[model samples]
Target: MALKLRLKPCERVVINGCVVQNENRRYTLTISNFAQIIRGSDILQEEDAVTPVRRAYFLIQSMLLDPTIAANGSGAAAEMMAQLYTTFTRPDIQDRIARAMGHIGERDYYKALSALRPVMEYEGTLLSPAPSASAPSFQTEGLDLHAGHHAGG
Candidate 1:
């Protein structure tokens, strides 16, 4: 099967562990054969992987991006799965995590990431502060926002 990819100007994509970037124009990429492709825009930067799910995501993404990463990250994959289990206790969430892990076990990195997306969204909602009218906002009348900093440089 042929996979046709339409890319915008300055877009970047990693194909079979090599990075290819379009310069200053729109273009279409055709993969006539099987290939591992990850778009630059879809990539999650390592530093941005702050949450447990994101950390797991980064691990899987790295494995997909590079074979060396895949070789070195097996233990990390197990640890990340365990962490996900500990963090998300809901049966439904756990099921999704297991599904992704199953894909991981099959070395289907792309599918694993796809399966993990909802868990990531759930984690985002869990971590984000949702403000309500009746919810108590902390009183900062006498609080210092920069308590640890000194006036002098």
Candidate 2:
């Protein structure tokens, strides 16, 4: 589905020039390809960024297969990219990714992100908000913070 993606350690990439069905078979093929990429690339040797990436991809695949993620309209897709962010080239890549994920359960995001940065950039779309979800909520009304109530007591 031609996705834009960002990976850890610094780089950008696109994914799926080839057609991919939203089925287990397709996902399995994708993961298998990913595994091969891992085997081929020397991502692991560079700054401790392999284990987490592999785990994150596993989690992403799991999320994509979930009906809830699919029903929510690209929740799975966002999560998938977010997972990749965990594997930054820098050491704190994991922490940053975890914070970005927020309430989402921990799944070694940092490690995974570091490892998959290349893959995401190569094969997926950049991370973006899900299609179905609304924008983040704001507490104050529009352009009237002092109008409705006194500021400074």
Candidate 3:
């Protein structure tokens, strides 16, 4: 099956380890073969990786975007994963982390990235300090702390 992508004007995407930028107009692309592809919006910069999970994600993203580092083995990725396992004692999160590692081992970078997203979410809840008892309950939606951006700010 082909993966079809409709990109906005000036949008960028990494396809099979190559960075491609759209020109003046919106464009559509059909990837007929297997390829590692990620949009610019989803690309997490290394400097933005603040938490342990985010750091692990950045390492995996780097492996996906740059084939050379992946070929050499991602020692940093393994180390980060180990640290995350030690830090987060939740069984479910640990299982997801293990699955992410399996995906990475199988060279399925996209799947690995997907698995890490939920792990990050769970980690956020665990690491966040509890609100005061008198304070009103608040929800954290569309809030990406690692991105250093607050929702509706």
Candidate 4:
């Protein structure tokens, strides 16, 4: 299979750890061989990796850049995931982590990264400051409101 990329002017991509930039015009490239490729849009900056999920994404991205360090990267990601498991008990977060783990087990950093993407957005939601008195609660939704002896008993 081939990976086709259509980049805009001044766009950049990381191909097998090398950063390549397009000129001031549209450019297209078809990659025929298996190579690690990450577009600028998907790149996570070190400074921006503040949350646990972001840090995991960054580590996996590093694996994409340098496949040789996958073991170290996986270890770091696993440590972070352990902490995250205790911190976030939501079903959705758990599901995403499980999926990412499967991909990681296969040494498919790209798919692992994709699996974590939703968890990243979820982390943002979890961390977003509550501005009002009626802020959202992190507790399992219906378990609090409907799962009780009070509702039916």
Best by lDDT: 1
What ordering of candidates by lDDT runs from best to worst? Answer: 1, 3, 4, 2
lDDT of 1 by residue, 1-153 (tens): 898989999999998799999989999989998676788887899999998899999999999989898888878897889778777889999998998889788888877888888999999999999978899678889878788696773
Model 4 scores a TM of 0.75
Candidate 2 stretches with Cα past 4 Å from truth are: 1-50, 68-92, 103-153
Evaluate candidate 3 by giving its C-alpha RMSD to the native, one decimal: 10.2
Which one wins by lDDT: 1 or 4?
A: 1
Cα lDDT of candidate 1 equals 0.88
- The residue pairs that clash in candidate 3, if any, are none
- Over 11-72, each residue of candidate 4 has an lDDT whose tens digit, in order, gives 99999889999999999989998777888989899999998789889988888888677756
lDDT-best of 1 and 2: 1
Worst 10 residues of 3 by lDDT: 144-153
> TM-score of each candidate?
0.79, 0.23, 0.73, 0.75
Residues 46-126 of candidate 3 have per-residue lDDT tens digits of: 888898898888888888888997886567777777788777788989888888888888888878888899998887887
By TM-score, is 1 or 2 better? Answer: 1
Among all windows of ten consecutive residues in candidate 1, which has the lowest summed lDDT? 144-153
Which of candidates 2 and 4 is the stronger one according to lDDT?
4
List clashing residue pairs in candidate 4: none
**Residue 130's lDDT in candidate 3:** 88
Name the runs in model 3 displaced over 4 angstroms.
23-26, 133-153
Runs off by more than 4 Å, candidate 1 = 89-92, 137-153
